[model samples]
Target: MIAKKILNDTFLIRNAKVEDAIQMEYVQSRCYPTLHESEILDRNHFANHIKVFPEGQIVVEKDGIIVASASSFRCDFPEHDSTFLEETDNLWITNVQIPNGDWMYGIDMGVLPEYRGLGLSKEMYKARNEVCAALGLKGQIIAGMTIGYGKVKDQMTIEEYCKKVMNNEIIDPTITPQRSAGFRWIRPLYNYINDPESGFGSILMYKPVDENYYL
Candidate 1:
């Protein structure tokens, strides 16, 4: 949470403050046009962490402006959880799925284009894992974007676009580098690429917060 000491002007990693909402939204807008323009998770939604922790959450800042961020929490899969959280007064073992353990899901990760060549994205991811490790989070999961066909700027139709990108031919160019960074796809039963209402090709990428997942 308090990570400024480990990073500096070259890059500053720290927890989010409530007032950083506007700036966080600015960075989010520049990096994720479709998501931001659609107002899927606006600053107000991101700011809701204040309801739990008035300070908001964790943030990855560079030169005083936030480039990326991740919250310290995990989603509860209630239907899959057949637990006794309703009856148990304390958690004896967290492996049972009913709010069993804490994990930091990578809520959003992005960087402005100009700052990219500096390897900021990779560094941000590294920091994310570090934060997860510091808090003993179980793992990190990210909903990655899918951009198909030659190049998004040059692609004419969404069909052609999907074919090329989905086929692993021409990626977003940016997201393609994730392979080397130790991220792996968490396969889903359905055609992840064909689902549009849910946004095409969005898959869960997982990275173990600790070596435990490997064990």
Candidate 2:
């Protein structure tokens, strides 16, 4: 696919290249400081993603510098599984990518602080959706962090917090945007990532491919 610029050529969104790994790593570090070092994917992981499912990995660039990125890979899970414990035990892309898996699992996404409000995050999700449709995948899934819940956790439980966010009673810096883009919460995942503020939990979300989606 041809790389396209958005917002009057101020930003460009395109498939990630192996050489872009270093910048992707930088963006991740800047975006998620509270996350443990072990939880963050390194350059090697990003390279592996390009080698495995290049189409599922995307990056956004501003004036030729990488400023945002999203990573995903295909993985299969039991349709009846409620918790996704076994399905997500190893959230790393290299460890979990399944060649024939029917669903695209979003592993990481981030945008630099300075690039916020420029629609970069939404473009990354749209890229993922396009990849899903291209591969004929059933849907896209994300173990999304409740990044805004830390401030309210003292007042309510995690489940309650998610419900409020879903009902528009609250806004999550992370989940709210995904919900607006058509994803819906499926359940809460425990130990989903090594995040301490959110108690290592994430809101599992999914968005089905539209029946008429085309390449």
Model 1 residue 91 distance off true place after TM-score fit, in angstroms: 28
Instruction: Please give the TM-score that candidate 2 achieves against the real structure.
Output: 0.89
Query: How accurate locally is residue 55 in candidate 1, as Cα lDDT from 0 to 100?
Result: 24
lDDT of 2 by residue, 12-61 (tens): 99999999999998998899898878677778878888888888889999
lDDT of each: 0.51, 0.79
lDDT of 1: 0.51
All candidates' TM-scores?
0.65, 0.89
Number of backbone-clashing residue pairs for each candidate, in the order shown: 2, 0
Candidate 2 Cα outliers beyond 4 Å, as residue runs: 78-92, 211-215
